[model samples]
Target chain A: MCFRDAAVRLRAQTIWSGVSLEVAPGEFVAVVGPNGAGKSTLIKAILGVHALSHGEASVLGLPPGQAGRRIGYLPQRRSFDASLRVRGVDIVRLGLDGNRWGTPLPVADRFRGSRRRDRERVAEVLELVGATSYATRPIGQTSGGEQQRLLIAQALVHDPELLLLDEPLDSLDLPNQAAIAAVISGICRDRGITVLIVAHDVNPILSYLDRVVYLARGRALSGPPSEVITSETLSQLYGTPIEVLHTSDGGLVVVGHPEAPAHHSDRHTGRTHERP
Target chain B: MIPSAGATGLSWNVADDVRQLFAQHFMVNALAAGTIVAILAGSVGWFMVLRRQSFAGHTLAVISFPGAAGATLLGVSATAGYFAASIAGALVIAAVPGTGRGRGYTNQSAVIGTAQAFALACGVLFVSLYGGFLDSLNGYLFGTFLGVSDRQVLTLLAVAVVVLATLALVGRMLLFATVDTDVAATRGVPTRLLSIVFLVLLGCAAAEVSQITGALLVFALLVMPAATAQQLTARPAVSLGLSVVLALVIVWLGLGVAYFSVYPVGFYVTTFGFAGYVLAASGRALITWAGTRRRATPAVTR
Candidate 1:
């Protein structure tokens, strides 16, 4: 996947501009930044849902959306009402044939083999994500981590070449976040599928990511995690004095100007001052 | 002329009353039209409730009031007005500039509410302009299954075939878009276009249901059965089929009961539907309570 001087504007406000980045096959990359850095917008632009105001982007050797059939996407987290009665397995199966024009027929057809193949694929992905135990349960009744796993299984059911996930770990606990990150990293390595994940905090996925694209102040800097996660780089990116502190366990904490606290925090609750 | 239940009243024999009910030609026509309306509304309403667009569905049903009234005023068939006004209202709602999320959703609801209110007012205006007796207006507003003609039954059947066929063609993609729109959009599903198509189909459903349950009580067919079925099961196909079955039961029983009484069919339909929904909801709650208690018992024993 590649972007050449890509820029996006919404309602006359330039979200981010002149952002050039590229990812190699099988690479696991994280797009991390403060809130309102347009990480989600970047994902949308790559998916061709949000048209770039300038420059261009290509995914899987084709223009964005043209290669949609081979690109799997998990949008930002959405809370399912407890009354929602859709089973987790059905959600996974939808990834396999949800885009098809017609409902599946119960009667045997010439394509019976393909129907069997589709069911097998859904089961395979569900097992892969460790959601087989609760696949038959209503998705809304599951815990947050369980739902996230089901969603990941849904994204992987079709075996796409490229996967774009927006905030897959937003509300998960630290352990679940680390586990999900490891699962995604394993998929990236074993299946050789390129991944672009948008995240609020970088610590959970820091160990597994091959590259990091840090966006802030209407700009982006992409490089190896080690090169771009330093205090100097982030401070420069935020256009403010920011400090990146490495913990004893190798996790990093970013703290900004005392009055304008940095937006990157592990616990993203009750802090509502971030810009959109 | 077919005999009215007023002559024989309802007998103690179950089979005999049913036989008497089906013996009337008008009753047969009502049942035929009701069956088609039930199936179409059941299937479509499943998605409508799933999408949480009951408000939009209600608005379309409300639009039918003005549509029927306007048609009556213009010396056209009230059915034509029901279709025309509801479809046009659907287009207007779909054209409203909003992504159906957050702020856009707020804007959409406001517009929909405005449209519904305006529609009701227009219905009253049309009725007054025509200087028609309140009896005809009551029929359109409260529905009349008594005088259903063969052509109306055929028309309802034709519309059901087309609507259900279109729904089948787009069912999978529509569910995908409704459940997880952003991902579906990235997957190249035309989420916006599908939403519009579903709304139009919903409009058609509202219009047809208005012909049976009346504009004010369309929810009797459009929401209750689907809601009850959903509460009973988590599987889409099973729940959808159950919705249809529940609708059929409600319509058949409601028509039967109404035939024996002085009340309109809409009253019995709404009553039976509400009863079913209450049963389903309470049953779900009871099961959840029992499960929690059972789980608690194990913890205490340990």
Candidate 2:
């Protein structure tokens, strides 16, 4: 699939500009950016919910709208209507096929057996995400972390070939975040599903990502982590000297102090060290 | 009043009115029309609660008053003017984007306010033109349940059945669209189509209910039942069933009460609906509180 020369503009803000990218089958890409960056916009544009003002985009060799069955999505945590006592099974079943509510389909295609299959698939996905114990529970009754796992299960229930996640762990605590990220990585890898996940930091997903794209201020840097996450690229993206340090704790940090103007000291220097 | 007839103290004749209710020409027509309006209101009210468009419901009712007022000033059936104005109001609001639009009810409020104001102005002008002791117009505005004609009732029933059936078939997609629109679109659910369908259904319901309850009074019967259902149950089917049941209870009760009082059924129904919502909400809270207390008690045991 191709996202060719894509640009997005809000009334008073520009999110993405002149960005081009390609996604292949079974690839897991991480999109990392700060707030107000174009990460989520990229996901939505690819889904065709938000049209690109300029250039063209396609999904799975088809336009986004036409690629419906192939793309599964997980949105960030938002409380659903409390009255919808939708069991985890029901939500996951939606991925397999939507809920029929008041409308019964015509005869010869009522999908009678589909109910059983949907339940089985729901169980399988719940098991995959360690949520089998609560698959029968109502979504509204679950905690935030629990709801997030269910959401992931819902996204994968149909066994879609491509998965798009919009900051899936933004609301979860640290332990849940690690748990969800691990589940995502294992499932995508085992199933050979292509994934594009957005998060504020790429470090949690750094090991599993085949490529990382950093979007900031309407511009972007994309490539393998080694190529695009360098200090020089990040500094330019943030409009400040950002230090990518191999800290004593064996972790990488991208830091820039806005108040400390003209002061540049990095334990690990790269490309060009700005003068103090 | 329907009476229980067995020593078992459990069974009762169901008024035998389901048949007789439709036997008399006026009853038959009023019921036919009522069924159509009920189904339309039921489905539209379902999504109206989902979209938090109760305000839209109220606004449409208010604005349609002017349409009725003007039509009646010339001694015409106000239904024609109401149907036209209601449809127009729904379409205009539907045309506006759903989010981040403006102050007061977003696009829903903005459309209602503008449409209603224009309607009120038109109504005054029409009244001025005719000037024939404009009490009939006022009565239509408030809705007279006794005024329900045979023809109007039949039309209401017809429309309701269609709306309810349509919702039944596309329900899965509609749910997907309402709960997680982004996900729904990605899965190719035709979210836009669902939206348009919802708007049209709502338009039809508003139009029919505008006849018996009057435009301004439809919400009492439309919104109350669904809202009450929301706090009472989480199951979609159950919620819908409860909504319809509650609306019927309130409307009929309001009608009965109106028979004993000077006020119209609309006033009584709205009051009853508001009280019903409060009661259901309180019940929900009580259950939640009890559950929490029960959980905390185990900590003390430990």
Candidate 3:
């Protein structure tokens, strides 16, 4: 995947501009940034749902949206209403043929042997996410972490060559965060599918990061975590005194970052606001 | 004619009532029409409730009032007018400038409300200008089930078939779009087009249902059955099928009861539909309450 000086604008405000980045095949990249830094806008551009004000983005040698079913996405976490009638396994099945035209006529499926094939695939993806126990349960009844796992199953049901996740760790507890991160990294290694995960904090995914694309103030800097996550890089990025601390437990933490803009934090929770 | 039961008022003879209900040709036509409307409304209203487009669907129902009234004044079939105006109303709603994201709800509602208000005014104007007979307006607004001709039933059947076939064709993709719009669009599901198409289908259902429950009470068939089924279950296929069954039951019961009473079919249908919804809602609440009590007792003992 490659973005050449891509820019996105909504209304009179320019969300971000002149951003460029590239990810090699089988790479796992994290997009970490403060609120209102246009991370979502960048994802929209790459998904080909939103037009860029300037420049271009391509996935697998084709324009963004043209990647079609080959690019799978796990959207931001929003609670499904309890009344939603779709089940956990059905959600995964949607990723398999949701974009295809025509009805998934049951009779046609029976004739073509696709129904059994689809059922097997859905089962495999559910097992991979460890959500098979409640696969028949309604999505609304599941916990946030369980729902996240199911959503990951949905994104992987199609076995896409490229997978993009928008805040796959939001609202999750620490253990869930670790589990989802592991699932994503495991998928990357097992399937050789390129992954780009956007998050407010990069710590949970630090262990698996092949590179980090940190965005601040309409600018993006991409490199290995050790190169871009230092005190010097983020301090310059946010125009404040920020410190990247290495803990004794083999985890990394960023300290002394400025308080986030009120609107920005309100819009996107789960950001790295810990002041330790 | 209601059969009297010795000293106990009305008899509860199911076999006789079933025979009497479809005794007349017009009654059979009404039964057939009701069946079609129930199935179409049940299917389409499921999507309407799921997408939270009930307000938009309600606006289209209101649009049918002026449509029928204008057709009456112009000496045309009210059914044709109902469909034409409601389809136009759907397009207008779809054309409203908003993607229904965070900031678009108020704008979309404003547009829908304005259209509804204007349509209501037009209906009043058209009714006032009609010189033939003012009582016909009541039938359009309140619905009349006693005099449905065979031709009208056929028309309803045709429209219902088209709507149901279209839904079957797009149901999967539409469900995906309704459940996870952003992800579906990102995966190339054409979410915009799907939404617009669903809106058009809602309009079609509204127009057909208005013929039985009237423009003012179209919700009797369009919303109640689907809402009740959704309240009762959380599986799409089961809920969808249950919605249709409930709708058919309501319509059948509504027509049967109206045959023996002085009230219109619309009133009975609306009453029965509302009753079903209330029953489902309270049933769910009761289950929750009982479960909570059970859990609380165990905690208290510990």
Using DockQ, give the best candidate's number. 1
lDDT of 2 by residue, A1-276 (tens): 688888887676667888888878888898876665667778888777678888888899887657776778886445554445556666776767773444423232335676565667778898999988876666667776777788888889888888989877665667777888899999889999998998865666777789888887788878898777778888887788887876574456676734232222121132121111
Against the reference, the lDDT scores of all candidates come to: 0.86, 0.69, 0.83
Q: Scoring only chain A, what TM-score does candidate 2 earn?
A: 0.84
Any idea what lDDT model 1 has? 0.86
Better candidate by lDDT, 2 or 3: 3
lDDT of 1 by residue, A1-276 (tens): 999999999999999999999999999999987777889899888888789899989888888768877888898776566667999988988888899988644443235888888888888888788899999999878888888899999999889998989888887888898999988988998899999999988889899889999988789999999999988988888777888888999998878733344444433454212211
TM-score of chain B of 3: 0.93
Off by over 4 Å in 3: A4-20, A51-57, A102-112, A236-241, A256-264, A269-276, B1-13, B99-104, B131-134, B293-298
Question: Interface RMSD (C-alpha) of each candidate?
Answer: 1.4, 4.0, 2.3
Residue-wise C-alpha lDDT for candidate 3, range B1-302, written one tens digit per residue: 11221222225787766776656667788888999999999989988888888888899988988998899789999889999989999988888877333123357888789889999899988988995445767777788766777888888998889989999988888888888887787777778898888888989999998887788888888899999998897767778888999999999998877777756778889899999999999998999899889989978998
Q: Model 1 Cα displacement at A157 (Å)?
A: 1.2
Q: Count the backbone clashes (under 3 Å) in each candidate.
A: 0, 14, 0
Error in Å for residue B140 of model 1: 1.5
Q: Write the residue-wise lDDT of candidate 3 on A1-276 in tens digits.
A: 998898888887888877888899999999988877878777778887678888888889998778877888887666676656668887888889887766544456566777789879999999998999997877876787888899999999998998989998877889889999999999999999999999887889998999999988888889999999999999998888899889987677777766543443466454222111
